[model samples]
Each structure stands twice: as structure tokens, then as C-alpha cells.
Target: MGIDFYGVLQVPRNCTDLDIKKAYRDLALEFNPEKLQKENAKHVFALICEAYDVLSDPLRRAVFDQYGEEGLKRGVPGPDEFIKPYHYHGDAMRTYRDFFGTTSPYANLLDYLQNPAYECMTKHGKMFQQKQPPITHPLCLTLHEVFFGGIKKMKIHRLVYINDEKTKTEVKEKILTIPIKPGIRPGTELLFPEEGDQNPNQTPADVIFVTEDRPDETFSRKEDDLLMIYDVTLEEALMGTTVTVNTIDHRTIRVPITDVIYPGYEKIVENEGMPILDDYPRRGNLVINFSISFPKYLPKACKELFRKGFELAKIGGGFNQYETVNKLVLADKILRVDFNEQLPPT
Candidate 1:
């Protein structure tokens, strides 16, 4: 017999629906069918599913709990027995006709041989058959067009070959927009059937919308959340200030800054932290990871300013400047900072 269903699921016999659901989720992560193929893994997953299928329903759980494994097997019917040939109506009709034929079956066979017809038959007979050639077309979509969700018009060329004749067909199809809900990661595929080809009998090929995330200059994906990084100049970092940053929503809003904001740093915050929740929450705070870009051809005025700063630092107190440079070059000394916008729960 299998292990106790409740014990295998790691839930008490009196566990609530929510508790059972959580247990199933935890087991699914470990025994995902697509990931594990070993015999043990498959057996474990099957047992887990069996436990859940029974426990999830109130009636099944009650019956199983009361009678154990024998209750499930009791009064179970066995496989059906094979019927005799004489029992079938179609077989009985065929037998009656064979017993009643007045002439011997060999009489017709002897007549074909007695005549010259048997010798006149050709060894090989041929028939002409026509085949329809399958065709494939080209489909393309921009990253932005699929993300926001709008109708897409596609032009496809088709080549039909019937017998020896060739015909070119061009068709324009409008694909209805599919809403790509936010928080779904890139590479998610949405398939729609009967929208690709016009074959009535054959199953129509699917129109697939593959999510290709653009090489974002400012955004990153973080498990159901979109992270965005922005650069803050030295002036803004030194004196804590608030600045308006643009987001996917196309609106600008003020976000407070602090000295803790530095380059290559991450700031994670809840959607509730943002002042702009439009029926639903959008992105939270901008992860202001600083980056510096210097022009190859510097102006004379700017070049001289650096030279003067270098000369003054060499003569005056400059130990801190050297230490800062050393820290930047050494990976061991690099620092990570997080400027969280939301407060921790009590």
C-alpha cells in the first residue's frame, strides 16, 4: 500500500483548504514533471497528486478516511469478457449467406480461367494522383507592438501547386490584439488557432506571439516585477534631493534621493510606495544605479580644471582621494547599497 495520503502531503488530517493548497504548491516546485524524469521523482509526484486529488474534495476525503485502501477497491468491476463470433448480428447475417449460395464459389473462378480474360489482365496498372504542396510564410513583429497589445496586420505570400500548374496567392490577415498582462516575463508565447491559414478540413496553424524583451536601456525583470536603473549626478548624490523620473506609464513623478544612492546599486520597493496607483499599481521606485560617461575629446577648459584639481590634491590633504580610487579598482572593497522606499511590516 502507499503511504498515508495526508502524511505524504505533509498536512494534518484536519488541514484547511488554504493549508492543503500551500502544501501542494511546495511539492510541485520540487517535483515539477518537466524538470524531473527519474522513476523515484515520477512516483513521488504521482503520489502527491493522488493525495491532493482526494484531499481537495470533501466527499473523496471522507470515504477514503473511513474505509482505507480496501474501500477504493471494494465492489470494483473487472475487465469485460470477449463476445463469441455467433453472438454478433453482422456475423450471423454473413454466415447465412455463405450457407445458402446455390453454385460453388469455384464455378466463377473456373469461368474467368476458362475464358481469355485472365491472360489479358495487365501485370501493372497505374492511376494519376494529384498532391497539394504545403507552403510556409514569413511573419514579423516589433517588440513594442506586441507589448502594449494592438491589432497587427500581416501580409503573407502563398504558392499553390496543383498537378503541374503553379499559382501565387497573397493574403492579408488582421490578428486580434492579445492583452499582455504586466509582470509576465519575456519569452512567454501566446497561441491562436484558425488565424494563420484558410484550410477548412486541416487544423489551421497557430499565430504565435512570442514576447521578445527589447535590449532595455533602463529596465530589468525581477520575478513578476520590473526593475529600472537611473543615473544620479554627483551633485544630486551629495545633497539628498527629489527628482522626477519617467516610467513605462509615460508620466514623470518626484522620487526622493539620498546619499546612499550610488552606481550599480539596487532599490526594491512595493507598488504601494508610489503615489500613482491607477486602478492598479505600476512600478515602484527607480533603482538609481549611477554610471559615468566621459567624452574622448575633452574641451580645453574642462581639461585644465582636472589638471588644477590634480595639482591642488597632490600638495594639500589627498589621502582620502587615493583611498577612494583604490576602492573603486578593487572588487573586494566594492560596496552594495539599497535605498528602500517602503517600511518593513511590524
Candidate 2:
């Protein structure tokens, strides 16, 4: 059976990283082998270290969460770098000494362990390797690429140690491959563990790729729905029209609009929008917002024809008795032209 890291840390699965750190600190102080009198103190202390080691790092924690201990200890079947598991150093006393920076595991550990500015001194005055902050980069993905899942390759340069003794270092280029899945939203991040600059004293920083959607000219995405604009003349809007919509999947759909398009009218073509990736073959609706264009000037003859047409169709409208407003006024004062632009169209 796999060990429950959340149970060991006494935290919820969705708990924040700070919660895990605080839990480990309290537990480590209590179970330090040098301080505890129990016979199982070493075993318990080692378990705590192992759990903290996995939960502290984002990459390791994600693997442990998804595949449990078996997948984490043995490699998962993939080419992605995130699947590489980090093993515990097998020295609980050393782990404790490195973290609290104490001469002895339990000797006055609480005094300076919380101090941020103090430089830690380990056993025999040897400092432990420190993990560095992650280097983050924006990954802009086009809508086309997002619709069709593919792999993206990135070449990055970082400083690396040349010798095992940590005597020399040089810059090296590393190629990172990220697999982009269909329907991945903006702000999804891919973590490449410890791929940043290398130093003798510090562990390299993890590289993070934050996903962002590139601006598209023809379509805009709103959650799962896709929006498109179609132009229509006033005559077509009143009488109804049929439109041929060119979809992202290269399908041409002839949608018939039989009902009259009133002001602020919008039509929905079902299951024609963005793909629902998790639920394969399912899709959201395509929303068509009609933009009706009015003629600049209406001739007297044409206007008369419109009135007769409406009367014949029995469309209820007081066309002859309609009130004309030259300058709109509110509370007996004429509103400015700029203010009229701000008003919703009737």
C-alpha cells in the first residue's frame, strides 16, 4: 500500500504549500531523534522527512498525487521531464540539520529556525544545498494549435556544473518539449523541474511555462462558447436570412434563420463551438451575433413600400402615427450628442 503523505503531514489534499511546511516544522521539532525518547523515533522521523521531501516540491507533489507511490518511485511511461521522481536523501538527521541549521538535530532548534535573515550553520559548519526560485516564461499558444493538440519544443540556455566536485561551471543549452492538449485554457502552467542556472552552493531553479491564448482576429472565446459576427442588411434582418458559417474545423454549415431578428438578437448553432477536450467529441455552441446595417438614406418610394409590406404581413406597428424626435431631451433639457452615443440602441 502507498503511504498517505497528506495523512503524515495532517493536512487536507487541497492544502496550500505553507500549510504543509508549518505542519512539517511542528512534527520535526517533536520527533527529532536526539530529543525524542521513543524507540521508533528514527523511523517516525524518517517518514516525516520522506513526506516533506515529496510534498514541498510542486513537481514531485503532482506526481505523487496523480500516480501514488508506485508511479513516483518507479518512472511513469512518458517523455516529459516532470515525471522524474525525487528520492529522499535517506538521512533524516541530515535532513533535519540542513533545514533547521542546527549543530545537533534537536539542540535549540526552535530559536533561529524561523529567522529568515540568519545564515544557517550545519553540523561541522557545512551548509546544505538550497533550492532556488523557479524561472517563469510566458507560453503564447495560437487558437489553431489549441484546437488541434500538438507538441511544442523550446530551447533554453542555463549554467551547469562541469565537474562532479563542483569546481567548475559552464553554460549549456537544454531542449524542453511540452505537450499541448486540446481545450487547455489560459493560465495553465507546465513545470520543468530544476532546469535553470546551476551553482555549487544551490540547486537549479525549476523552469515554468505559463500558457496564454494569442489574440485571434475572427473569433473570441468565452469559456466553452465561441463568438462570431455576421453582417446583415436591415431588409434581411426583418425578413429573415440564411448564413453560411465557416467553422474552425473546416466545416461549412448553412444555418437557416426563419424568425425575425429583433434588436440585440443573437442566434445559437448547437455544438459548433470550441471542442470540449476532457469530454471528447462534445462541444459548446457557436453564438452568432447579428450586426444589422441600415441604409444612409431612405427614398420616399422605398419607405412607402416598407409600410405597405408591414401592413400586408399583419406586423403590428404604428408607422403612420409614430412620434418623431429631432433632438432627444431628458427632463426638458436636450441631451448632448456624445451622451446619445453612450445610450443603448432602441
Candidate 3:
């Protein structure tokens, strides 16, 4: 049977990347190969490490999802720049000793609970030794591409020392596609092995994906929620019409307005006695506001109607009035669309 990454780590599929890393570190430290002398014990520990290697990498996870373990074994193409590397086997074993008390495979972890050695192991040592790299490299990625998942390829240059002389060398750099789970906040980093210069003494630096929001797209500032602003005319607002709202999904969803429609950006949804917010009884409202604008290239008759009916103020050399901050205005004129309200009383 294939290894189950989530199952091996004992974390939910939706668990954050940091949570997954922590889980792997805890489990690996407990069952490190160096700590285990028995063949079976070492075999099981290797499986855990393999699982971590695949799951921790976004690209490897993608490969695993499609081709399983056998597929990921295929080599990824990149330039072979000589790197200073460390033995992963050594690091895993050292981490195992640090997290759990017994480095011996034969040592019963349960028994360690009764002994004092267990405390010493976890408390005294660092999980991985830190070594400085002779040179540093930089990489950058976009927010959406990182969140939805994508690939990043770059190159790093390193200086090689020959007889105390430096020669510039370049290595093909590849960060396989990462599959970022939903609801992941930005500023999360993913790490890889030996990802540094010639004297690769440094622990792999994390690929931090920072979150950014586009101004035109309305998105929820919080988890498990969405926000939008709608503009309606005085007639539609009073008549309680069906407003077809274009959503982030690029489709229109019709929502009904009520007799309580107001002129300003009104919080139609507020807490129902929730102590954290004002007791407005509506918990999740898309504050609908009202506004007035004239068709610039209006027919002479329409311009006459606006001039005769409403009060106007001067704006950019044109007469206008302060109204609700109309977020849904399209250029030229607003589309005053009233979706069909009644369907033959069906």
C-alpha cells in the first residue's frame, strides 16, 4: 500500500503547512533511524521521513497526487551546480534524539516516561544544527500563484574556491509547484534540502508566499466569509426588487431587497446579540449603498430630465451631488437592472 502523508503525520488534510512540519518533526524525532537499531524500527522510521519529504514539497505532493511514490522518484530537470550538502540521514537521527529521550531503537519510549533521560533529550538539544552559507540567494513568487499552486524556476550563482581563488559558477534552481491548501494565510515558507551555495552549511531557507489582495476584486478579509457592495436606484430600493449581483466567480446571483432599504452604505447584516459586534440582528450583510450619476453621452431628453428633477453640485467642472459611495458603477452609466421578481406566482 502507498504511504498516506496525512495519516503518517497524524494531521488533518486541511492542517496548515506549519502544523504539518511540526507533526513530522515530533514523530521523526521519536522514531529516528539513528536512534533505532532494529531493522524493522529503522524501516518504519524511513517510511516516515519519505512521507515528510513528499508532503512538505508542493511539487512533490503534486507528483504524488498524480503518480504516487513511483512517479516522484523521477528526476526533475535542473542544472547541476555543485552545492555544499549535508547528510539528511544524520539530521533526521539527530532530530529524533533531540525530541525524544531514547536514541536507542530498543529503548521503550513508554519506559522513558518513568526515567529522567527523556526530559534531557527534549530539553537540551536543537533539532537541526545551523551552519552559515558562504553566499546567499534570493527568490520571489506571486500571491495567487502561490495560493492556488504553481511552479517557480530560477538560477543561483555560487563562487567556487580553487587555490584560494574565487570562480563564478551557476546552478539551475527549481522549486516544484506547491499545492497550497485553502484558507492558508500568506507569509508561509516551504523549505528544501541543500538549497544554498557551495559550502551549503545553511539550513534551507523558506520560500515565503506573501498574501496580497487586488483592489478591484472584493474578497473577505476574514476566513470562511465573503464581502461585496451593491448599488441600487431609488426606484429599485423602494420597490424591493431582485438585484442581480456579479460575484467573484464571474456569475450573477440575484438577491432580494426588502422594504428596509436605506440611502447610505447600510450594514444590513449585524450580530444577533453577539457581544463582539453591535446587536443589529443581521450577521452577514453586504452593505448596500445608494448613489446618483448621469449618462455622460446621454440623449438630450435624458439630460433634460436630470437637469429638471434633481439637485446637482459641481464636480471636475461638471454638476454632481454627494451620494452613497457607489462601488458597482461601470463606466459611462450605471446599468439599472431589475431582475424579474415574480415567476407567474409559481
Candidate 4:
């Protein structure tokens, strides 16, 4: 039997001209070698193009309908004379480019298919069309992942049509693997072109994954710097001590507190923060904020001993007298100190 032109394009034999056009356009795009990744894509696409060519023209279609393929090859007679034999002499790729007015039709294939109006514009030489906006999604990452780098898999569900019918649709899940680079800043965006939701009329939007650092109990990130609060007892704050910090990578870092830690004292550990993105060797500083916790109350004997000790430790200077008095009262209890008197200039 002769090749079924209507079956080739998947249109019924009684289908209208509009139906034939729609079917041909849809199948052509679906089977286009650049769009479809099938083994016999090129061969199948050529067959569809041939079917469309013979079925779309009024004269050729009438001849094929009456005489079939062999009749067309033998030439059909018209009222005045025999109509010349019909053959698909045009290049398939050239025809597709002319129809879409674009060499890369797959880039916006979905848009053309979904928006008939846009396709009409393209057919009339209006090649420029507004692109769909990029879709952004937050990708929450832990401090450990940002510090050491890791891979995150995100599952995205999108609506896919079962066939050309718009009524029937199915939700498809796609897993996207995102590489988290060391020191990638929060709000950094990774773009996947044309991977967003699909529509029959519009092209798929670009997918954007924005990085967001999840809150960590041990450290809070500020740009590339890591901030941590270290609590110390009154004795440790006053006397020399060592504070051990647990890092995000399960490593212990020892921070020495030799000097007395006054209120508002911040220890800066250089090159201990998050690694610089791309340049992993460089790093920011880790800032340690100290909080001193004093005992709730001190016994009368203990207060007296602390008073006597401050007097003996003549840790003096021009301001030694005031320092000694302030320490004596403040060490025993929480006392507010105000510098009311003017001091001699150095």
C-alpha cells in the first residue's frame, strides 16, 4: 500500500486544512533532529516533512487523494493539460527555518507551539518575541556544605502534556544536581537555561537556583566572615585561659585568651572563616564575640578577700587608683561605673 500521508502526520483523513497544519507543525517540532534526541530522528523528520509538503498544497493534495503516490509519479491530467508530477524538492531544514524565521527553533520551540499568535507573527517576519522571565528558587545550604563544598540534588515537578492535547497533562519530576562551591556567598545564583515550567504556547523559562545559607548553631555567616559568640566565666575572662571552638568540619580550634577580656572585646582569628568562592585558598576572618558570666552572688568573706587582693596588686599607673577602686566594687557585685571626673591628659 502507498504511504499514508494523514497517518504520517497523525491527522485523520477527514481532517481540515487547519487541523493538518497544526498536526504537521507539532510533529515537525517534536521530531526535529535538534529538538528530539532519538536515533532515527532525522529519517522520521524527513518523512513527516514530505507528508506535510504533499498534503498542504491544494493541487498536490487533490492529485495524491485521487491517484495516490504512484498516480502522482505518473502525472495527473487537469482540464487544460496534465499537471506535472509532484515531488518535495525543497530542503527540509530550509523550509523549517523559513516557517519559523529562525535557525534555532528548538531554543523556543515550546513558546512557538503554545502561543499560536507568536507563531503567526514569526510566519509574517516578526522574529523578535519577549522571552519568559527566569524562575528563581532558594537553595538552602548548611554552613558545613559552604565551607567544604558539596553537591545538592533538587527535585522539581513540572506539568508535561501527554500529547498535543492541552486537557490531558502529567506532572513530571526532574532531579537537578547543583554543585555547591566553597565560600559561595548567600544570594549567589546558578542558572539553568530553558529548564523551567513548560507550556504549549510559551517557551520554558530559565531556572535559577539562589544560594541561601541555613542558620548554624555554632557560627553565623556575614559575607565571607564567620561570627561566633564564646561565653566565658568571670575567672576565665579576668585570668589567662584557653577556649576550644568546634568548627563546622568537626575539627577543634583552640583560641588562647591570655589578656584579660574586657566587655566589648572581640577576638579575630584570621584566615579561619569561609573560603573564598572559586579561589579556595583565600579566606575571611573568624570573629569571636566574648560574653562574661559573673557569679550570682559573692560571700562576705570572699568580697573582703577580693578587696584586699586588689589593694595589694598595685597594678598602677596614672589611673591606677580609680582602676583599683572600680575593680574592688565591680568584682564583688554588678556596679555601674560612670567617669564623671576629668582626668589629666597623657
Candidate 5:
């Protein structure tokens, strides 16, 4: 009934939201007024946009299904609020811009003509220009830069059409400034629409910048968290330790290790890692891994003295209480060592 919105989008009345979207994308690409350069294209795309907007929305689709196109356009009562009448904003490019920003970004496009007469100049038929493949470049950032948000300026060399007839071209340099938000994940891509070289008889391509984090020797990143390896002497590992560390963001923190720093021990500093994306003033934990460094050489007398001292203190008395250490270790070497590699009993 009325305008047949479903027919405009080339989708069935019982079509799914995904089907509506697919049909809309196809039609939008086919009749995108800017690319097609036709007056009729503008009206076609408007109907396509209106069809997509109504069908893709569940509430709107329900209203439109219950009531025909005219009824939906005349407005209806809703569960919570009164639904407004269906109307395309008449700016097809604006509607297409909304879709282009969200979807897979597969669309042929050229410059948006300031003059409306340009739409009429292509009188015979609307023609779509094929855009070239996008160029990808890595935007390398230091850990600190990723922590603190900043702007990065990049230079691009592109070929521009020199003449009105588009026969001659010249190489032009452009600087694109990209904003680096805090806690932006690695491998995130930034897209610059139609900002590439325009060769003769060919349209310009899009530019994409992929974010990459530079390696930090002191601190290693694990998602939003960070891993810091701190070294401690054998004495400090046995007794106690405390140390101050300079964070990547240039803040010094003192960590106390009152408990014995056992091997493979970790200290977690909360909210000290990379900043959380979209949530400012929040961060992940900074995990400090303890690396114990033992002295290279210890004489038998010193070793025995330390063992006797431990025995006197009644700390771990029966763990290694063998009478003769050398004979015991020598006895167990063949039996205990490399059990997997040892020969089976004959």
C-alpha cells in the first residue's frame, strides 16, 4: 500500500533486519546520488534510506507492519511514547554518511560537489566512479605516548588533477593529524576517507593507519595490565626488601616487601598500568615479578654456617637434615636425577 517501502529497498515484507540492511547497502551503493551524479538518484536513495530506517528498527517495523505505509507516515501511538511519522530527511548524502561511518566502508565515492548544478551536468545518466584500494601504514607509538593521549601529524604524498578536464595531474603533499586517545589498543585502525592519489582517469583511494605500540625494555604490556621484572639480592629475598620504581608515566612508586621474597613472587600495584579506554582515571594493575639473584660462589664454611644458623633459629629444621650432604647427593644422583632419561630396570 502507498509507496511500497519494501519494494524500494528490494526486500520482502517478511524480511529480517539483516536482510533489510543487505538490501539497503546494495541499493545505497547503486544509487548514491553523489557517485551516480543523477537527480533521480537523489530521490531513489531517499526512498532507500527511508526504507532501511523503518525496517531496520524493530519498533518502527512493528508499527509499519501493523499499519500500512500511509498509516506509519501519519504517526501512531506507542507503548511508552507516541511514535512520530516516517519521513526521510531529504538529505541523502547525510543519511549515506551515517551508514558509511558504521558499516564495512565498501563504497565508491568522489569529492562532494558544493554546487548542486553538478548533479544535473551528468545528464545522460548517473555514473559511479570506482575508488582504488586503500593504502595502509603503521602508526608506531611509544608506551608513554599510548598512556598519555596526543596528536600525531603524518605527511602523505598524493597525485592531484591539475586541469579542469582532469587530463593532467600533479603530486601534492598533505599532512593528516590523528588524535591518539589514551589506552587505545594496538592494531586499531584509523580511516581517512578518499585521501589518496588521484591518477588520470582513476579516482583516489582511502588511507588507513594501524596503531602499533613500540617495545619498552623495562615494562611489558599485557592488555591493560603491565608486567615489571624487579631484581633482588638473595639476602633481600630471604629477609625483606623495599624499592622505588620509575613508572612509564614518570611517577616514582615505593614498593615494600616485608614478607620473604620467594622465587616467582609477584606484587600487584592496582590502578597503575595503562589507562582504560573511554573510562578516564581508571587503569589496570602493575604486576611486579621478583627475580632473586644469588651469589655466584659460597664457601662450604659459609654454607654450613648459614644452615646451622637456620637450625638454631628452628626455621625449616627437617627439610634437608641429611647427615652427609655429599654422599647423600652422590648416592641419589643416578637414582633421582633425570628420571625420564634414566634407563629402565633390566
Candidate 6:
């Protein structure tokens, strides 16, 4: 007597397709070599795979259901009087990979239970040697592009096979349009599944476009915040100054400098940064860091005036004169001072 495939899989002959799949999945998991430590695990797993292969197909199932394994080996005659050989070509590991869409044979059983569609053969089909890995391409975008969402079309060249034999291949250019959302962060990935290389025996790999923020000349980003460095003259650092800033949206913003501007001073303009992702109205803050520029060669009279001004300010008894002097002398050939008491307004 031949082995009973239905008994091996714990499914009845009258069981539905879905029931058969479920039973096979259970048996496969129980006999998986990675999960089971029994001596005959490998043999049992092979048997489970063979059972699924024969029962999953309508023609083979009908042959086994009627004349059993003997009929399967001797071949069954179709209505057209042609005898079709019943053979199992599926590998146990490959079956698992096709079900899970991954190469790992040690898949979590709970995952299969939660989403049975993940193991649906109709969805992922099967895996073959011609299967290729996903192709990842970098999509470089400017800060301005990220600020204002738009659609961009990219041109890509993909290989196209000429015939089923795959004897010849041709390169074809395809235009792919990608939607860029507002405040799209770097490292965000967009996937075009099964759009990679073409082969006769296997499904194509996925084509992935990964977002990357290109280095901008004027701005740097921290999430939704925009940071920029503004150069101010030495005279402007002491007195008040006004700066005209060109925003990402092509708007001109006047940033007034009323308080004393020190080196590393940051001025924040709220709601003027990058747009919040998915929340168009909401925005982050624009941070402006100040850099003071001083004349390399100052006249003796100008130095005397500056020294007198410092001495007079020191007489007021509110500033640290010695630290201020040291900073002015060693300040990258320019006066650089940190006024901790003069903090930026929230």
C-alpha cells in the first residue's frame, strides 16, 4: 500500500481547497527542520511538501483520488486520450520562500496565522533560480522640492526579453512619475514591486526609489526645522541690523535684529520652516544662526574707538570685560563673544 497523502497532511479527501492549504501549512510548520529537533524532521518535511504538491493541483488530485499512487506513476489519460505524467517539482524550502516572500525558512508561525494571505499561493506564486533581488536607486531632492510637494518624472532603462526562450534582450526606457509629498524626509522609500529585471522562469525583482536630501547651499534640515547661517558685520553685531531672507517658497522675509547680535546667536522665525508632512497648514521653525565678520586689518583710530567703547561698557559693571577681551583677540581674526545673558526670545 502507498502512503496516504491526505492522512499525512491531516485533511479529508472532500476538504475544500482552503482547508487543504490550511492543513498543509500546519503540517509543514510542525515538521519544519528549523523548528523541530526530531531525527526524522527532514524526511517528514519532504513528505509534507510532496503531499501539498500533489493535492494542490486539480489534475494530480483527481488521479490520486481515483487510482491512488499507482495510477499517478502509470499516468492518467485525459478526455483527449493523452496520458499526462503526474510529477512533483516543488522544493520544500522554495515552497516556504514562495509563501512568505522571503528566503528565510524559519518563518514565524504566528505571522502565518494572522495573515493567511501572506501564504496564499495565488498571491506570491512560486520562487525559481531566476529570481533577482530588489533594485534600489537613490532619488536626490533639494530642500525646496521637499518644502513644496510636486510630481517628478524620472526616466529609467529596463531590460525587456524578446521571447519566452529569453535568447535576446532589449533595453527600454520607461518614464516613472513619483509624487513628492510636503516635508518628505530623507531615507523615505518608494517601491515599484516586480519592476526590475525580466526573466523567463522567475518573477522580476522590485524597483525601489529611496529619497535622499541633496546638500543645499543655503539651508540644512533637522526633521521639519530649517537652519541657516547669516553673516553680519562687526558694526551690525554691536548695533541693530535688518536682514532680508529668501524663503523656500520664494517669499521675502525681513528679519529685524534689534538686540545685540553675538557669535553663534540663533534667531527663530516660527511657521517659516518646512511644511509638516501630511499636515499642510502646520510648519516647523526657521532657525537663523549668526556669524560675525570683522575687517582683517583695522585702522589704529578704529581700534582705539572700539577699545574705548569696550572700556566704557566695562565701567557699566554688567559685562565680563576680561573674557570679552580674550574672545575679541582670539576670535578667528574677528570678535567672537557669547552673551549668555542675551538669550533669543522663545
Q: Which candidate has the top score in TM-score?
A: 2
Residue 179, model 2: lDDT of 98
What value of lDDT does candidate 4 attain over all alpha carbons? 0.77
Provide the TM-score for each candidate, comma-separated. Answer: 0.34, 0.55, 0.32, 0.55, 0.54, 0.55
Per-residue C-alpha lDDT of model 6 across residues 1-346, encoded as one tens digit per residue: 8778899888888998877777776666667887776779988888888888888888888889988987886887778885677766657877766655654444544455654533333322221123467889999999989988799788888888987767567888888899999999999999888787775435578889999999998899999999999999876776658988999899999999866777667899999999999788799999999899987999896687568657865985746444454344445333334567545779
**Please, what are the lDDT tens digits per residue for candidate 3 over residues 1-346?**
5567678878876777666666776677566655655677676776676667667767666656665555456544334732222123434454445444545554444544454333223222333334333232333433233223335554444333344423334454544444444334434444444445442222333333333433344433332234555665554553346656554334566666655355563433332111112222223333434442323465685555444433332332333332211222221133343436423444
Candidate 2: deviation at residue 154, Å?
A: 1.6
Q: Which residue pairs collide in model 6, if any?
A: none
> What would the per-residue lDDT of candidate 1 be over residues 19-121, giving only the tens digit for each residue?
7765764564466444565768766766666667667767556655765545543423324742221111223213222322322323223434554323222
Q: Rate the local accuracy (lDDT) of all candidates.
A: 0.48, 0.76, 0.46, 0.77, 0.76, 0.77
Tens digits of lDDT, candidate 5, 30-136: 77766677898777778888887778888778988888788888999888988889776676666677876532223433322332222222322233344577999
Tell me each candidate's RMSD, in Å, in order. Answer: 28.6, 20.7, 22.3, 16.4, 17.5, 15.6
Q: Which residue pairs collide in model 1, if any?
A: 263-290
| Candidate 5 ranges beyond 4 A from true positions | 1-128, 309-346
- Mark the 10 consecutive residues where model 6 has the least summed lDDT: 120-129
